[model samples]
Target chain A: MNLLSIVLYPLISSLLIRMWGGKNPKLAGWLGCVSIVLSFVVTVKVGLHFFINSSLEPISHNLLTWAILPSHAILFSLKMDVLSFVMSLLITGVGLLIHIYSLGYMKKKEYGRYFSYLNLFIALMLLLVLSDQLLMMFIGWEGVGFCSFLLIGFHFESHKNMNAAKKAFVVNRIGDLGIFLAMMIILAVLVQEKQLWSLAFEDIRTHLDLFLTKSIFGMSLATVLCLLLFIGVCGKSAQLPLYIWLPDAMAGPTPVSALIHAASMVTAGIYLMCRLSFLFDVSHFASEVVMWVGIITALFGSTVAIFQRDIKKVLAFSTVSQLGYMTLACGVGAYAVAMFHVVVHGAFKALLFLCAGAVIKASQGNQDVYQMGGLYKDLPWTHAMFWVGALSLSGFFPFAGFFSKDLILSHVHEHHLFVFVLAMIGVLLTSFYIFRLLYLVFYSGKKRDLPGYITPWVMKAPMIVLAFLAIALGFLWTPSFLGSIDLFPQWMSSLYMIPFSTHSLWFEIGLSLLALLFSAVGLIAARKLFVHGPIADQWIKEKFPKLYQLLLHQYYIEEFYYKTFVHDGPPSNRKLSQDTAFTNSLFHFISVIKGMFDRYVIDGLVHWFAWIPQFLGSIYARIQDGQIQTYIRWITMASLIVLFYWFLWVSGMIA
Target chain B: MNQLFCLESYLVISSFLFVIGLIIVLTKNNAIQIIIGIELIFNAAALNFVAFSYFRPHVTEGMQLSGQIFAIFVIVIAAADACAALAIILSLFRVFKTTRIQNINRLRG
Candidate 1:
């Protein structure tokens, strides 16, 4: 099957599900599930074909031209390189699992709508990955955003869910503006200098030298465009300042959290950076900004996750933290490493979310970790799956996160030690929060004698598959000391090479050991804090009240935003009682001017403009008075006058 | 034919017919009288064409009967126009109960 068909298959299924899905939701869900699985099957074939034939350049199939311009045009095409193939596999493969899991998770709800949204998300994500041109990708980009909004607000009956959906969409829209500006700048620069106005990934790479040479405001055009694109990345991938929306996005269903937010959609920003790696490669300043923003976001999210008691919110923040690591990878010019982490993170994080969904289902919608206890005995399969996911997430040995994340750390360590130190701290917090969540939910306190809820095999099946992937996919790429086999990275190296740490093998091994040691410390810390009766928690609350409160309140970021955006004016809130009469009058004068302009200048122009035709039409209305004799008399008089003039002229008397 | 009537005489007859029709139509208020006036105008136009053709037999390159054909087409079109106009007048008169154009001014705008 063609690569385009893989995207179309799920879209066709989504439409079908919506049409015939009202009365029989079970069938609709299955239909949606089967379509994604079929796409995944085809993706597997395509991926294998690409990997087996190493000589093939990125195969592009131009479906049609999207727009024809005087200078250049963009094609509605699909490209299946190793990078896209990997992303496509992750999307469709993990998407299928999430679908099967949703069959159980959303069993009693509007299965038709849920499954249809899920199917559409997969289709759009595939479109995003497979698109050859950035313009074409934008369609899928906005499409996935819309689906994210729809799914986030799926339970629209509640005000909180609706608010969360709106926040996610509005924040993403702000980032989308940045993307649009970046695209315009790139196109404009290329057209001006190189006479090339194309949006294809290949074209951009080819003309990147020209783009780098062009200067805008004393900054390279490449730097400005890259920074603008990074803003879009911050929005989609949940980096600092724009990271607030992802936590609130936990209002969505768990499968949506797993598939769209965690596995695929959030990774779109990373994919974009990787696709435009050539641009970043030439812009050191922009890459530094990307690296710093990423590490800060990593620290920020993981810190907030430590205090979040809600299970999904913790996972949501952890997803943010992990995405920060990927962005950091991109920042360091480790494009292949970033993509490697994307694939590995897709597996385990999705696994973690699905397991959390099961736990939430078992707990009867109780999302707070403190509310539940001792589920390790009752739900063994879920506990086992959640353990695998947690281990992988914490970068434990032999799991997917370890290899990919260690790769990122080694690269960072080679470049900047301080940023590497910050990233290590982020890793420590990641493991601590993940383990804190694990121990608090599964191993702490006495077992509650609750009624047994049978989690259907459908949900368990996907978790089992994802757990296996979380454990095994790491072997695809490993460091030098562990019988180094760089399979995945080597396959994707044709797009952009991931700069391996030039440090010695022993140093690389030492870095891996440090990662392991930190994860171990985090695990032990979580154990001491959360395993027994809340002794450490109480001691911390009592001894360091302000710090505890600060962590608990998320450093009051939301309150700060609300105060600035919704409550008081910016200057007044910044300095209390700073609003003087002068400022007030200034504001008042502006408002008065605006009001006058709106009422008089704008409306008066419109009214007079309208009155012009009416005034002229009144004068012209006399000709058609519906009086036959009057019109005939006028015509006769005019004709007689004309004839009199003509006779005199012909007699040569008017000269 | 040229001995019996000259082009100038024919032009005077047609012009008189046209002026009389225009005067009668402008003065009258009845719908039937207006229709009679319009028929007179049509006949004046057709007579002008036939008279020109009769006086100047071969004015164009091998197109001797062009004016007569045009007059025939004018006559045919006038007959159709008269039938449709009379039918419309019948409907208007039934609705307003008047044959006078001034009273039957439903289509004023």
Candidate 2:
């Protein structure tokens, strides 16, 4: 398969669907599915070829020369080594399943538009992962962000959803600025060093020594570059400060949440870090910053997830937290471990979201978990799949997340004890929140009567496949003690040459046991508190109203942001009257000045220019009176005066 | 030279005709009288052109009749103009029941 076709298939189908599939939604949905399936098949073919030839060189094909400069040319190229192969497989594979799920999930009227956006999103994400150059990757990066905004505001009828989509777009743009600056700085440094200007990952790696030795603003250029890149990472992956968009991004359709937010697009940051692992490997300070930021975000997200009432919001925050773990792994220079966690988390998080979608559908779009209970019997398949997802997410033994998360925790343990402790707390919170959600939604008995909505087989099939992955994907990278090959890490090790920090079998087992213990503790605690229903929540809410409000309001971070940046002025309840009075007067003075300037300076100038034409037109109006004889008399008199003056001048030859 | 055929005599006659035409156009109330005054002014200009061509001191052999040709072109244009002006006056008479210039001032600004 031509690698470019992997990106093209979905893009062409998106345009085709938009052009032809407007009236027949079924055909549109099938078209979208078939294109993604073809892309997936191509990815699998590439993967199989790589598997058969383990020592095969990273496959690179330049589709065309995108730009030619005096020094070098920028090629629109694709590369499929182990990293791109893994990510391509994940994007196309999960993307295909989500497209199928969307068939049953989306309304008929929206089928064409929704599938077009989904396919465009898949195409962009494949482009993001497969592109060999950073410039091409950035294009894919922005394209996916745009697609996310479109899909999030798919229901444009609601102002709230539109606001959420705008928020996501604007926030991602803030991170995108960081990436833009980083690219400029890279190009500038290359030019300054008299090196060929190339942004391909391989080229950057080959010239990594140039960046490491240089300094910008009294800091290592590599550190600055990596830190700037991390800002982009923070935005796309929904880490600290920039993570506000992801939770609100739940306004999108559930399949969008499953595919873009949870499975594929959100992990692009991790993929980028892994792709450029060579650059990051040099900057210890930047790596520390990455690690700490990840830790805080992990804790923040899991804690916020615990308090969220909306099922999708909870999954959204859990995705944020899991993304934090992957970032943290990348920070520790364990790019392989991060990639492992990325693939596993993509599978289970997508499964979890799909299950949540089924529940929300069954409840007729009631996302509030408080309103749902005892759904196991009604939605047996969804319930079972949710359990698989929740267990995998919470790092239960032998599940996908257990292997990946434990790998991350062990790597963090080797790096720093404090980080390891914080990560353990994050693990406990992860288990607590996910189980709290699971129990609240499914195990609290019947909270109220729900409309009996059957889960369609179309939705059921994807969930079934995902649940199997969530259960068995752990075997792909089992610890040595399990006597299984660590296939995922070995596959990734070729791309990320960082040596794995090895430990004894007993030490590894101890760490896994400790993580399992935390998981169990969180589960038992959730069962104890939430098994009965809202009584425990009511008691807690009454006992600690302030704390409850804090958690419920997401630590008031969104509110703080709104007040500080979005609000025009201080609220009316001011503590300092004198200060408030002065500021108010100052604002009034500025406004008055602005009003006067607008009235006199800007509008007055325009009016003054307009008056010229009006004044001349009024004077000229008298001559256009309709009497033809009067006009003839004026012309004859004027011509007589000119003739007399000319005769006198010509007689004397006057100058 | 005969006084009636001299260039000065022809110039004086045409100028006098032009002045009279101007007076008629300025004082006329009837639309037909104004049309007649315009035709007079055109004939005065054509008469001057023919006088200049006939009396020129350095008239070339091929260009000796150019002034007469211009006079012929002016006479043809004046005839077409008279026809169009008379048609307009006839339409005006239908609309207002009179051809007086002052009464047909509907196009005044």
Candidate 3:
């Protein structure tokens, strides 16, 4: 199997399914699954090749030359190094499970188009991970973003879904601008200093020393580039300021929420950072910014997730918060740990989202945890899967999230104590909210009577597979204190030159125990408050009504953003209208002035420019009356004038 | 040459024909009358060419009959133009139930 086939298989199948699979939706879904399976098999073969050879050389193949320039050529190349291999393995594996789950979740009528989009997403995501060049990776980045938008707005019949998709897209573009600018600066600096214009990862690595010697705007060039690229990461990974879109992005189908938003596409940011860990390692200032933004986002996402009642919204925010953890790991110069979390997070989060999809399906599309209770009786398989996912996400011992989260916390502790404390609080919040969701959805209140709703085996199969992964995948990267094989970092050591962790075994064990304790506290608190019904929730709400409301409204950040950037006027203007009589009159006076300026200055200028064309057109309109006689009469008079001029010129009388 | 066939006489007669054709085209409402006026202008131009070629004083060898050949070509072209213009007028009449050019002003911008 060729390396190109890993990306090409899904792309070709997506087009084929879109064109010919319309008549038989089942066939379309099966075809999509088959293509992804083929791609996954090829990826495994590549992995096996690396294992057998034990060679540090990456498996790279140049598909085609995209462009030829004076200095260099841009090649559309695929490389399966340690980093790309791990990421693509996660993408295709999780992606395959999601595609299968979608067959059971999506409506029959939309199967062909839905699977086509899913397949396209897989193809683009694979491209994103496997590309050898930064330019090709950007193509995959934008392509996946496009696919995310398409899938997010799949239910285009609803205006809300469409709006959410647009929100996700526009926010992502803001981040994409950073990557674009970084690429430009890289090219420019390379051209100016070394007369080299290649954007391949290997080429950039070889020329890293050249960038350190250069400066941009009085700061190190590497720092600016890393920061700019982090902007893209923040957008893609849904970090603090740009995270509003991920929650809204749950407006898409549940399977899409599982695949694109939660599992694969959102992790592209972390993957890119890991891919360029060399540059990030050199820039301490950029790493500091990344670390701060990441920890703050972790806190912000988990805190807001606690008050969310929608099942998918909670998971969406959890995904955001978990993404923040991965970024945090990256920020603290733990690229392997970040990647390890990405892998383990991919397994558990995708499992949770798929379980959520099953629950939503069994409940006949109801997503509110407030309305759903005691679902463990009706959806036994989904309930079991959700337990696995929740435990893993909560960083319980023997679960996938425990190892990765512990590793990240240890890394943060080594860097800054303040951030470490905040990260621990984030960890507590993560466990609390996820268990809160689990308790509210499955254990609290009376058992829901879901008539004729059965969790299909097709869906159950993927969940079971993912549940096992969530339970066991953490073993890939056990800490040194555990005295186990740390295969993940060892596998990735070629890509990341930094040592995994240098702390003594006792310190590592202590931090792990501390992380485990925080998670336990969060679990006990959630069990006390939510597992027994609404009594404790009522007390909390009654006692701290303002704080409850604040959390429920997500700190009013979305509203503040809307008012400041999207609203037509200041939010204060609306408040002032209902104030005292003097303020009301003052508001009216201000409005009058504003109205006058708008009408006379802005509209008047537009109208004046518009009138110029209208005035000229009206004058010209009279000349084209379509009357042959009038046209001929004008022609005759013009010809007479021309004849007279010719006569004078011929006689030399006009000289 | 005879006085009736002289260049000056021919030029005067052609100018009169041109003026009459232009007036007919500018004033007439009937579409067929416009076609007839255009044919008259073509014939006036052809007549001027034949007259100038016949009355020239220093005609170059092998080019003496160039003006007469152009006159013949113009007459042939005028015949074809009359056919096409009449066909268009016929269709216009069928669509509007009238041959008046003013009523066929649908081409107005």
Candidate 2 lDDT over A129-235, as tens digits, reads 99998899999999999999999999989988998999899999999998999998887777677666668887788888989898978889999999999999999
Q: Best by DockQ, which number?
A: 3
- lDDT of model 3 at position A149: 96
Model 1, stretches more than 4 Å misplaced?
A533-539, A567-655, B1-109
- Listed per candidate, the RMSD to the true structure in angstroms reads 9.1, 6.6, 7.6
Give the clashing pairs for model 1: none
lDDT by candidate, in order shown: 0.87, 0.88, 0.88
For all candidates, the clash counts are 0, 0, 0
For candidate 3, what TM-score does chain B get against the true chain B?
Answer: 0.92
Candidate 3, residue A535: how far the Cα is off, in Å = 3.0
lDDT of 1 by residue, A1-655 (tens): 3888899999999998888886788779889989998899888877777657766477777788745674476668898988888899899989988888888998654888888888898899899999988887988999999999999999999988998899899989989989999988877876777777578888888887877777889999899999999989999998887877888899999999999889999999999999999888889999999999888878888898887779999999898889999999989988989999999999999999999999999988889887777998878899999999999999999898899989999889888999999999988999999998999889898677657987899999999999999989999999889888888878877888555667798898899999999999999999988986345656878999888778776787765564444334333244523444455556667778989999999999999999999999988897887888879899999999999999999999897
Model 1 agreement with the true structure over B12-108: per-residue lDDT tens digits: 9999999889988999988888888888898899989988887895577768887799899989988998999899989988898998887766689
